[model samples]
Target: MLLQVEPMIPALRRYARALLRDTSAADDLVQDCLERVITYWNSRRNNDDTRSWVFAILHNLAMTALRKYAGTQGMHVAIDDVAESQMVARATQEDALHYRDLMSALDALPAEQRSVLLLVSVEDMSYADVARVLDIPIGTVMSRLSRAREKLLRITAAGVPAAAPMSVLRRVK
Candidate 1:
């Protein structure tokens, strides 16, 4: 059981970090989720998808923490400051700017849509799996993903230069 779950740690960490945005907080959440899973490992159904099961556990824990923190302190994004040297070494100016724009667009999305988008795009989870993880209907997952994509594209496009004019095609029977 431990061996099976060990391989999934990196994925859980990535998901947690994406959701929390703070490395320490994401680590704590993953730890807590792992603990909970270990406690109930025997009770889990044999036929269940272990990856999805663990992901669901992590998602629930994250939601609970968010709710508790929201009531006490209100919700907000926590930005991590990077050292100038490290930043320069990571990416070129254009790449950095594009990454910043993408992150901004992702951050601007509603929590529901953001969750669905990350689960699908980042984690490569199927719509059905995302729906199960988020406890939403599959159709809702589709809707949120669609809206999130449209919003992200619109947001990012604002920074790009307009394309050259193109002729419109019309069909007449």
Candidate 2:
């Protein structure tokens, strides 16, 4: 069981980091997830994929944390909290700007959409696996992923709709 879970650590960390946007918090969540998996290992169905099972554990823990945090201060990602090295290593100003924009867009996403997006795009999990991990239908996972992509595009587009001028409508008497 340890060997099976070891190979998935890096991917799990990446997904966790994307969700929490804080390295230490992400690590803590991962640790909690691993502990939960070990504690419940015997109860899990044998036919289930261990990888998906572990991921499901992690996702549940993240959701719980989000809820806890939301009750206190609302869930949010601190883009500025990211490591300085990561922010400074971009090859050019344009790349840095784009990266920041993408991160902002991701941070702006609702938790459900963000979770599905990261599981699919960052962890490279199949849609079916993501659905299992998130405990949603596969079609719902696809829909969330699609909406996430569209929102990101709109956020990064040349003209963000939110920033556009509002037109005044005059009513004829």
Candidate 3:
């Protein structure tokens, strides 16, 4: 049982990070989710979809945690922060610009749609699996993802470039 779930840690972490948008908080959510799974998995033996079960657990945990920390999301962080965390900085300038455009488009999405889109499109979960994890109807998942992609396409086509990433430390001249 322990070994079965260990392999999912990275994926769980990635999903948590996308939803929470903070590394430490995301890790905490993953930890809580795993603990709940370990303690409760035995009782739920007929679990048809372990992936969905784990996701349902995670979704509940995230929602509970959010209720406790209502005003501390820091206004969803900045658009560049999410992109900078994902960027490799190895692409050509044009590619870099396009990548940034995509990120900005993604960043423009509401947290709910962004998360659903990431789980389904980027994470490659099926619509059913995504609905199970997110605790929403498959139809709702499809609708939100469709809207998210459409918004992204529109925003990127507008050719708007966000400000460059900022340096955290001041350099002595």
Candidate 4:
């Protein structure tokens, strides 16, 4: 089980980081998720997909944390302050700008839509899996994904920075 779960850590971290927008907090969340997975491993149905079950645990934990912190202000860190070594690769100037714009657009989306988008597009989860993870109907998953994509296209096409203000960050919770 540990060996099976080891390969999922990177994807879990990425999803957590995208959801929380804070590296340390995301790492903490992933840790908590893994702990819960280990504790409850035997309780899971034999036929259930482990990936979806793990993601569901993570999503539930993120939602709980977001709610817990909704009314409080936390320390804010600028992206430029992050160490260069932490980046996966050196991006060209154009790629960096494009990636920034894309992330900003993603951040502008409602949490529901963004969650659906990331799970489907970035994590490569099937709609059925995403629906299971999110406890939403498959049709709802498809609709939210469609809306997220359309919104992203419109934001990128406008060539305007869509990053929400820091004061509004908690609204995504």
Candidate 5:
């Protein structure tokens, strides 16, 4: 089982990083996820798809962390505050701008749509597997993915960040 899990580490890390948007926190989440996977290994159904099950575990952990932090002012640092040495040099200015734009568009998506998009496009998971991991119907997964793609296109085309929906915007108490 360990051997089977070894190849999945990079993918898991990428997924976690994208979900959390904080490197250290994402790493800790992945560690916690691995621990849970190890502790509950025997309890998983033998016929279950290991990849889907593992992703489901990671998703659940991420959701819990998100909920836990939902009420707090999240730690956010501006790019100018970071040291120049920490920034990776892109091959071209255009590449860096495009990358930034794409990431911004992704960040603007609702959590549900973003998760479905990342699982399907970034991680290359099937609709069925994404449904299992996200605990949504396959049709819901498809609709979310479609909406995500359309929103990304709109955001990128307009060269403006999409506004968060009213429900997604936290009210200041």
Candidate 6:
């Protein structure tokens, strides 16, 4: 099973890191998941949906962690943690300067939209699968995906709404 499951580690890590934003926390969660799988491979052997099972575990763990962190810290998980990778994919160094800007745009998104976008774009999960994973209807998954696309497009297009005047002036006091 190790041979079969070993290849999933990277993808799992990427999804977990995206979800948690904190590398150490993500790593710990993934380790815990691996431990769970190893310890319970016997019962899971009868299940054919290994991919879904793994993601379900990771997603549930992240939610639990999020809840505990929220209760203790009274803080939100910054979307920047998830958007940092998107910021890195820009075409030039100039684009890199706007990492926080991109993050802010993503931060404005509702959690539902963000989760759908992540499942579809990052995890490459199908609409039906994402629906099941999120415990929502398939139509809801599609709707969220559509809205997320609209928001992301508007967000990443160019100058910020409030900065348009300053951007056009190209002058600093």
Summed backbone clashes in each candidate are: 0, 0, 0, 0, 0, 0
Against the true structure, candidate 6 reaches a TM-score of: 0.71
Which pairs of residues collide in model 5? Answer: none
RMSD of each: 8.8, 5.2, 8.7, 7.1, 6.4, 7.1
Error of 3 at 115 (Å): 2.3
lDDT of 5: 0.90
| RMSD (CA, angstroms), candidate 6 | 7.1
Count of backbone collisions within predicted model 6: 0
Distance from true position, residue 75, model 4, in Å?
1.7
How do the residues 1-173 of candidate 1 rate in per-residue lDDT, one tens digit apiece? 88889999998999999987767789899999999999999999998788888999999998887777775653354445444675457787889777766776778889899999999999999998898888899999999999999988887778742232347899999
Model 3, position 136, has a per-residue lDDT of 85
lDDT of 4 by residue, 112-155 (tens): 99999999999999999999999999999999999999999999
**What TM-score, to 2 decimals, does candidate 5 have?**
0.82
Candidate 4, residue 68: CA error in Å? 1.9
Better of 1 and 2 by lDDT: 1
lDDT tens digits by residue: candidate 5, 63-107: 999989988886887888666867865468888677777888898
Q: Which has the greatest lDDT?
A: 4
Task: Give Cα-based local distance difference scores for all models.
Answer: 0.84, 0.84, 0.80, 0.92, 0.90, 0.76
Off by over 4 Å in 3: 73-104, 161-173
Instruction: Count residue pairs with overlapping backbones in model 3.
Output: 0
Report the lDDT of model 4 for residue 79.
Answer: 78
Residue 92 displacement (Å), model 3: 11
Q: Give the runs in model 2 whose Cα sits over 4 Å from its true position.
A: 71-95, 159-173
What would the per-residue lDDT of candidate 6 be over residues 1-173, giving only the tens digit for each residue?
A: 79867888887798778777667688899998888878877787464467767776777887888777875653365776566776567667666557656656666678778878888998898887787677789999999999998988886785573223333546668
